[model samples]
Target: MLRKFSSLILIILFFTTNLFAQEKPEVQIGGALRFNYNLSSWKEGQKTRGGDFGYDVFRVNAKAKYKGVKLNAEYRLYSEGFGGGMLKQGWVGYDFSPENNLQIGLTQVPFGITQYNSHNWFFGINYYVGLEDDHDMGIKYTHNDENWMYAIAFFKNAEELRFGSASDVSDSRYSYDVSSSADGLYRNKEVNQVNLKVARKFASGNSKHMLGVSAQYGGLYNLDTEKTGDSYAIAAHYELNAGNFNLKVQATKYKMNPENPADQDSEGLAMTAYGAPYLVASEATTYTIGPAYSVPVEWGPISNLQFYNDFGYMNKANDMYEDSFMNTTGVLVTAGNVYTYVDLAQGKDHPWVGPAWTNGLAAGTPDAEWETRFNINIGYYF
Candidate 1:
């Protein structure tokens, strides 16, 4: 399947290039390279430190605009092993007006804050809960004006295009078993997802304020167990930019309801946040807040510096289980075309945020109380 997809991508690229060559469409190319070094400590009486140097991501983005129609695509290569290479985004859109447009193909879902401002590469807890950078194969319509912006999208699958064997049910009771093999696509059968968001921006003196509401709903059928499940979330977000300081806050409530509770454990859906396990609970409420201050400076090989902190907390409906939370503090330093991030992160009862990250706990196991990590990331964009 992957080979076929690769071939299809090549075909599209070849045809599009040839077709656009005659029209002399505007073309632009850009990419980024990043590296990471990390050290970690676990609450389970384990300490580990390791550093590896490689391409965190090597992306090639191509865009062409002819008349009111535009085509944009990005292909990425990762050192972390993401099936050798993957399509990060590929979409075509038409501008009906300056404020309205329609996009189709694989694109980011319109939900939550579009871009997260985290000094740490891991971002906030929302990323772990499928509220951050979640892409899907879908069509979306968007409208934007001076003060108001709105978007709605419909997705055939929530994450990837699954075209393989049925999922394994051995751990179905503990978490979502979307595919039988790890290499297979991670998605549910007969799934449909809808995402919508509306925002209003207001300017007050030197500060800009944005308030938004977002919602997502999805229904899936488990091919392996012949069972069905549904999930939904409602969120509100606010952002304020004053002078050189910026702040953002968001709260979301999500619920995963299964056809048969006995068929699944407390952990509702098995999701990933940047390749890390982010299990959505049966019912949970999460909150995230970030504040940042930027300082302009001129020094040797340094242009600017920003200090920021991100905090997140997730409270489960079942108090019997511990709450999940994370705190990250870091600084972003910019030098010419290169950027650097230094971060210190700590978390409790959160798998992805911890050093010993795991998909989900065993059916009867409990999460560790605490974990810590320090990370440094360097990236260059061109």
Candidate 2:
């Protein structure tokens, strides 16, 4: 940890020295810290129970600008959020034109329709977004100006980097009887992605309304076995300040591959099972919608605070939407309205114990729907 901190300082120093080397030092640094507590209620049998806790998130961003050229770097220091972590984001980008730019290094893939949000609308729905824990160490090109934006990129599969040799395609495995080993350190599975996004905003009266659409495609390039996934999201959000009323709405649709037989094994199978046969295709789709309300505080110690509430409903089109898995301790965490637990596997309806790290559970079923999660959070930011 000490080494990491020292290295980070050195990197910042190097950038600062070089940044001031130029005359147009448009350097800017800013970030936010938010701590929130959530009270969860779950539905099981005929009883309803609740859970509570808190998490802190600290984020920072540093940027430098020179005319049309801009460079950005961001990091997040977190304490027990979705999964506890000091993990952060590090990327370097350059804007060659107002409509186009290229970024390389470590960054999120554009496969999932939902963007990692920066606001406090936490008490809503969770969308299936993200390429597992895979962060590509490659390049991404994006073109956007007004109403339309498109992105394409190739990534070094994070799994392959940790296990496989850079020169060869090695097969690795995780979980029982599960022939598909897409979750290994050196998973040689070929992964690639392409995405397109369109958005527009309109101003009327005293409010602003925005609409957005997102689409993504992903699959392996070399593996003979068939395993692929994709997502599509459409959302509309509006803001109107009438005295003290604020309102917004968000919705999404996620289409994923159907669950495969190889994905689930009732018999306790040992690890190291690999190179299993799989069907060519399957499909699962989910839809979710919700709204948000906020009122700015105008009194006492809460003068600068904003009170907000958000709610959503998710409809599963098939078995692909239910989360049926156990905690690390072999305790079954069934599907439906469970709070305090985040269904980490957004790819399948089956449950895989979350980052909380329980015993007795394996990772990522061959083909599972991302579990559905709804959470509410109250917080204050300055």
Give the number of the best model, judged by lDDT.
Answer: 1
Best by TM-score: 1
All models: lDDT?
0.70, 0.38
Q: Which ten residues in a row have the lowest lDDT in candidate 2?
A: 326-335
For candidate 2, write residues 100-202 as lDDT tens digits.
8877766555432334321233222232122211244456777765445566665544223234333333222111111233332212233554545555645
Error of 1 at 97 (Å): 1.8
Stretches of candidate 1 off by over 4 Å are 1-23, 43-54, 80-83, 117-119, 165-190, 260-263, 273-278, 359-367
- What TM-score, computed on C-alpha atoms, does each candidate reach? 0.82, 0.52
Query: How does candidate 1 fare on TM-score?
Result: 0.82
Backbone clash total, candidate 2: 15
Clashes of each: 2, 15
Task: Kindly report which residue pairs in candidate 1 clash with one another.
Answer: 167-179, 167-180
